[model samples]
Target: MKNIRNFCIIAHIDHGKSTLADRLLEYTKTIKITEGQMLDDMDLERERGITIKSHAIQMEYTYNGEKYILNLIDTPGHVDFSYEVSRSIAACEGALLVVDASQGVQAQTISNLYMALEHDLEIIPVMNKCDMDSAMPDEVEDEIIDLLGCKREDIIRASGKTGMGVEDILKAVVERIPCPTGDENAPLQALIFDSVFNSFRGIIAYFKVENGVIRTGDHVKFFNTGKEYDADEVGVLKMDMVPRKELRTGDVGYIISGIKSSREVKVGDTITHVDRPCAEAIAGFEEVKPMVFAGLYPIEADDYENLRASLEKLQLNDASLTFQPESSLALGFGFRCGFLGLLHMEIIQERLDREFDMSVITTVPNVSYMVYDKQGGVQEVHNPGGMPDPTLIDRIEEPYIDASIITTTDYIGPIMTLCLGKRGELVRQDYISGNRVELHYKMPLGEIVIDFYDKLKSISKGYASFDYHQAGFRPSKLVKLDILLNGESVDALSTLTHFDNAYDLGRKMCEKLKELIPRQQFEIAIQAAIGSKIIARETIKAVRKDVTAKCYGGDVSRKRKLLEKQKRGKKRMKQIGTVEVPQKAFLAVLKLD
Candidate 1:
């Protein structure tokens, strides 16, 4: 048990957390059971090079005649999934903090490091990407000593991409990371970090045995909710894409106790003994909430049932997601869905396209808001469709975000100017480890709810990285604008905007919508309005010339030919009447740049 070590590989986005895990898997011979194998079992995880889900693996190795078991957890680097990262940190006794030798420390790295420290876990600093030409190990080491307050010799340098210094990093984990310290004789208790589904094997819950022995056939209970179940089987984390057998205390593993669905297995929930459970559950646990939302539906109304069923299946695996039936005057029927961030929204869209083989139309994304009415009524609105009457709104409050940008000083002026244009207030600036500087800004969630990251990257020539966190809500005058085409409000073109910029935004957004919409047989007048007042207008010219299928008098069949041509024209006219706007066109306006 003393030889067992549990640690998570922590880093910023694109800082090589997954790549380092791959190298560690090879070094520890975890994938040796198969030939030409990939360490990450999930296809999506490998393609993105970022860990979308936290997964643990068990591997054994021998050094100087002593065997050690390494339980490694790979965590997501992006800020949207910070909840998942916190769970991973709690499950481990220590962390391998991976910082890019070239890029040095970043905003997300600081965020994740603070989380690790809050867990009171031992930290083993590791510098990755040392093989790159831009690698600056000396400066990064100094930053670790300066910012993290670590000794000069504490940093372990390596490259997870090329498998350099990986074996040495593993050795450091065994030497520096402490073994599991909880009492093994106490009642069975484990903290659930992640869970997955098995068609034939039911639900598999991955957890850390924080206290006591966890054996097969022991009855378990969730401490807070008092929900009970039987632990039919206990097992260690394996890379086989299947369940293995009996994991003991001082080990991070999985258990399949007849949990038929992942719904019962919530992350951060405590699994404890049924008769003699732990006295208290872990504190400071909060459920993950979806921040932004949009309506998603299939074009064909017949696919409505299929779409709903598909979303339900996906939600069974991810409880953090929320969705419900939403009907539109234009779309007829659809579902409104909520997501954590832009990346989460994109991932869900891709999955719907690939897994369900369905065509979906998603509306422009919008953040949730708290609206106060003149009658002293308060309501929370997640979608513009649910917004209250404009006349009744007394005050509108929107979310604010604390944004940090890491960029070279050469592009500071341009980036600052861009932020100002987006209504961002500069908070502070400081010099980071590498010649890169960190600029802090307090910006409205609406400003960055669009293309802030894209503009930052473009201005900084892809060298700038941006990350943001919720900084609470502030009172503001906000309004929703409805774009109309030929006196009919297009459900797809409805969006939120500030009262100050509402007119300008409406004009630009309407123009972009018109550019995306094709010309019709009848001229379409695109207009933006607040309530009954029109603010801006653009005209989409009618098609001057259309397809003409003419036929000459052809003896007896001439009349029949004319009838066939008339039928073809009728079909074309019907197709033109039901012109459903595409999702890409609605999303284009949000791109701004």
Candidate 2:
């Protein structure tokens, strides 16, 4: 226990967290071969060039003739996956705060630093990417000192790409970071930081043994769910799962107990021996609050149950994902899943298809709203179709967020314009170190639901680092905008938006829908409406068949007769023809410029 060091890497996205992990693993001879971002083994993570999940691996290193067991959990740097970072932090005694030497002290960097401090985790600041020519080590060192209040020598100047200062980092972990402190003889108490489902082995839960010891074939139960299972296999995580006879206190390892049902295993749940359970559950683990809500409907209505099971298994892997059963008039049966942001939503949709074989349609994302009826009762609504009628709704309050953006001084004007265009109010600005400024804003969550982050990145030329936390809902002039096809409302495309931008948004949605929805045999009128009032409209002209092509040089009466016949046929078709809203049309709301 005294030789074990548990630590995690936390930083902004693309700050070389994975790269640094690669260097450490190689230096310790954990793996004979090396690959870029080897910790990010998922195909999606590789293709997207981002870490979507936290990966845990054990490495043995000899320092001053003393071998140490270093349990490292490399975490995703994106804000959407911050929950993963938080869970990783809870299971460790130390954290390596990786900040890019070129791009010093971004928003997520500060946010992750605060999270580590809140958990009382010892922080070892590592200034990564020092090999790059554009790297400003001195300036970034100052920024880290300002944020972490650490001395100059405390910061390790490392280059994940070139393996520079990699030795110092490991040395710091041994000398500075505290060893895990828990009673090995006490009742078994472990915190499950993460879990993954295996078809052959059932659910595999990775946990840190805080107290006591867990041995193979021991009966253990989860404190939260109260389900007991025999530890079929106990092991520590290396490049692969290395089976062990027992795992001691302050050790991080995986437990497989033949738990088939995903609901039986909960991430962040406490594990203890059934015979000698702890006095109470471990504290400091908080439930995640999803910021964005969207409906995910299976393409085939019959796949609803299968989709549910898939989501259950997926949820075991991703604890932050929340969903409940819901049905829509337009999209049939589905689940309204809550996510952290747009990128998180997209990743889940992709996973459903790639990992679970479930093809789904996602509704336009929105934030939950508080609808206060005339009777003074407040009801929360996540979907536009679930909203109460305007007559009964006395007022609506939408969720707001306190957003912090770290960018160079050059892009401040454009970033402000982008935020203000979305009705964001500037809170304050501070120059933490040099020309890099952190801008704070109070903005409606709905405004940034779709393309706000993408726009911020583009406007700042990828220099901006943005992170946000929810501020409680506030009263706003919001209205539900409904899209109608031939006067029939499509609930899947409905959205709740601020009243001031409703007209322009409605107009853009209509125009975009016209471009996406295919022209039927009869003319289709696409209209955007708000409570019986149409604010914007577009017409998809019918694919007309030229009935007069064969009437060349014919009498005027004959041509008129043919035209009249075609017109009557068209009229009949209009009455009976049903428009098929293509899948892209449902996604048009997200692309409205």
Top TM-score hit: 2
Q: What TM-score, computed on C-alpha atoms, does each candidate reach?
A: 0.90, 0.98
Would you list the C-alpha lDDT of every candidate in the order shown?
0.80, 0.92
* Model 1 CA lDDT for position 31: 74
What residue runs in model 2 are displaced by over 4 Å at the alpha carbon?
A: 552-554
Q: Assess the local accuracy of residue 569 in candidate 1 as a C-alpha lDDT between 0 and 100.
A: 65
The TM-score of candidate 1 is 0.90
In model 2, how large is the Cα lDDT of residue 396? Answer: 94
Cα lDDT of model 1 overall? 0.80
lDDT digits (tens) for residues 1-593 of candidate 2? 89999999999999999989999999999986555788999899999889998999999999999999999999999989999999999999999999999888889998998999999999999999999999999999988888888999999999998999999999999998999999999999999999999989899999999999999999999999999989999999999999999999999999988899988888889999899899999899999999999999999999999999999988999999999999998889999999989999999989998998898998999999999999989999999999987889899999999999999999999999999999999999998777888999999999998999999999999999999999998999999999899999999998998889999989999999898888888889999999999999999998988888888795899889988998899899988888877888767678777
RMSD of each: 4.6, 1.1
Worst 10 residues of 2 by lDDT: 31-40
> Residue 196 lDDT in model 1?
69
Error of 2 at 83 (Å): 0.5
